[model samples]
Target: MFGVLVVRLPEGRLGFLRAFSGMLAGRWDVEGYVPPLFDREARASLEPQGEATVKALFARAEAMRASPELLTLRAAHAEQSARHASEIVALRERHEVRRKQRHARRAELTEAASKSSTPEASAHAAELRDSLHALDQESRGDKAERRRLEATHASERSSLEPKLLRLERRLRALDRLRHMVSRAVMRRIHDTYVITNARGERRLLRSLYERAQPPSGAADCAAPKLLAYAQAHGLRPVALAEFWWGAPPPSGGRVTGAYYAACRDKCGPLLPFMLDGLFVARPRTFTPPSTTPGSLSILFEDRWLVVVAKPHGLLSVPGREASLSDSVLTRLKARYPDATGPLLVHRLDLDTSGLLVAALDARTHSALQRQFVHREVHKRYVAWVDGIVTGEQGRIDFPMRVDLDDRPRQIHDPIHGKPAVTEWRVIERRGDRTRVAFFPLTGRTHQLRVHAAHPLGLGAPIVGDRLYGRDGERLMLHAESLTLLHPGTGERVTFDSPVPF
Candidate 1:
């Protein structure tokens, strides 16, 4: 029976065995023994020892057969392993090829990016080169131009020196002459002439005077005597016939004819004058009495002061005019007969309608005056302007000044005006219009209106202000809220007016 067993040899033993087998196979003795074993049989007859030898030989054959089969299996396994290795190599080659392709693609992408950026870089480089070239050209040109200008300037200076000296002397003399003439009567006469000429009346006077001038010495002699002789003889009428003739001719017969003939002959060329009568009309003047009652309704009154709603078109105080017949102060005085020293604590423009505070007594007046002057009294205004304000809240810190020539007109003058400030926030927007809350930091006249119109660029001019806004309308600035400390109670007092816009 053929049997096979798998056994694990020790590490060094397997190699040692393999070497021993090789050495044995190389020996002549082993080769000779192999031939004898194969001689079949130095005959089959050698006792039971022959049977044993047969069994041993059979066992050896089986062992040899098993080794060759194992060798075959090992060789097949090795061949499979080699095929697997080859397949692994091919896969690796494919992987390498894919990796290289990926690398190549990455390189291509990098190159594309570089190319894309190159134009911009090249453009920047070109600009820099042009700028540098321009600078070099400019530098070269500037040197020549500067030298030419310097030479020209030097020549001009040399040529102008003597003329400048002469001009300076003449200017000084002229200045002295001007100073002298400024105080002279001739200068006054010249000024009067300039004034008359500017009025266009001087030409009329010149024409009349030229016509009145007599012919040389004839005025001193026979001309006067002849004019007197003619007057006596009724050749020239004593009543001045020109005056009697009036406008359009009078219906008279031969008398008119004889009068015309005598005047034309004696005063020969003395034409019958057609007189246009001049009558000057005098302007009627009237002193208007302060009879108009104040429109402002007094809501609250105390011993120290009165609080009232100021009506539009009423002045806070009396103005220097007969037309400005009645004002708030005058009406208040008339209303409160017993009150002494009625003083205005603050004032709103004549067109502005809002809450106003008046001082009844001198002590309260001084106190309130101090508060306003020191900017301790807080004022709030509500205004409606044109256009949407971009920011929610903003402060205008521009300075303002009144135009001296145009009275009451305020202008934004940063360099030479008083510091004025206003803080404002938009409350609501209706279409293109915006309602804003204003807090004036400094109380300058027309402060809020100017700031809103000028720097803020909100188009809505204060409604009634014809100077700064639409004309033939009432100003729309409303004193919405006012806060101040009471002089008597030492408590804070507040007043508010409803927005009129």
Candidate 2:
């Protein structure tokens, strides 16, 4: 990435700081651009020595893997795992026998309680109920014990061996040593990456990432370098922008000189730390959805199925966190307390407002799910995109997968991604923004958003897509319509939701 920060010098002179990410031709300092955010000498010396040591450790480990001493150590580990397995098996068998006895005891108590009528018999039944409670405790204890044993077994497999049980111990030891050396080097390398926020508070690159080691090329981004230079030289930053001016990397597409946002994966966490105390107008401010409804809009309801209008910013289902408990699925469950199976037949993205269908019965859920799997269910989505589309209609076919580093954001990956297909038609031209309709034939997470933003697809991101494009009021994509066959009647039905944006 190439970055420029327009700055006002302390002497009232106008100038701009420029930087490029990472080293250029094995050098951090270029005559014209700003230097890297690191102690130059320390970084220069440490990298080479540390890398050599780590490589040596790997080579040693490889040689040790087939050594005689390593074999003996591996065998010892195997024996311990085997011993643990046998002990657990024996304990399980004993628990099984006790379980059978407990079952017989419960049966006896139940029968006695049912038959008792006299006062003396009733007292005896009460005593037997106490015994049943004790048995319940025993059952719970057995389950707990089983859980502990299973956990230990799993740990042994993970730490000692799993599929490679026959070649263990020494290999792990060597690997651990290599990790220790690498981490120590990384920590020292991290220390040299000294950066100061606008507040004049300096921090190491490692401090910014609390729970994680900084990803490769963390503080080496053009934006971070430019900001650091501006702060050190008593220059007040007026404006900042980054652009690409090189061949695109293998991971994603890029164009030379196209204005780009600071990378989410690399620069996202760092910018917050660097921009402290600056008059950052857009300093990644939170622009929450304009409205949050107290309830869902039901479009259709039958004995076997129900359809809902999912508002943008409302989750299709409740999230794992307690704070995210409100959702269409939760409301649906409350509305249909006796509903069976997984109520949702399909789900929409949290930012997508649309019509979603759900089943009230297991058979209906299965039938509807099968239709979706077979590509029989048709979906239409409408979105306001960032650029003018030349063609009226076209098909976008690509494979996509979640960008693991930056979650929820997907990238095109034909090798590892699931196949996604979307057909689109231009609805109208709205100056800089174009309103378009999308018909996705396959359901992949973020199918419409990625398809709309990808270079090979529209080459224009949806206007309000925060992940793939710039942030706006909310995502402009809406699930405009859905068509599917009714499981109850075996007849076609289509549902439409009002486009709020």
Q: TM-scores, in order shown? A: 0.43, 0.56
Q: Where's the lowest-lDDT run of ten residues in candidate 1?
A: 14-23
Query: What is the Cα-based lDDT of residue 122 in candidate 2?
Result: 63
The sequence of per-residue lDDT tens digits that candidate 1 reaches over residues 1-501 is 001111123332221000011123343123221111111232233324534544555555456445654456445555655665675566557656655665565566545555665648766556555655665565556456556655664564465455445544554565555445433422222222110111122221112223433222111122222222232222321222111121111111111111111222222322111111212134344332233433687766778878888876778888787677578888888887777665778887776668788888889988988888888889898877655777788888777787643456677666778988888888998887788888987888878777776633343454445555443345667888888888888889998777767
In candidate 1, stretches whose alpha carbon ends up further than 4 angstroms from where it belongs are 1-294, 456-459
**Which portions of model 2 miss their true places by more than 4 Å?**
2-18, 23-32, 37-219, 223-290
Which pairs clash in the backbone of model 2? none
Model 2: worst 10 consecutive residues (lDDT sum):
248-257
Query: How does candidate 1 fare on TM-score?
Result: 0.43
- Please list the Cα RMSD from the true structure of every candidate, rounded to 1 decimal place: 59.8, 11.6
Give the clashing residue pairs of candidate 1, or none. Answer: 464-474, 464-475
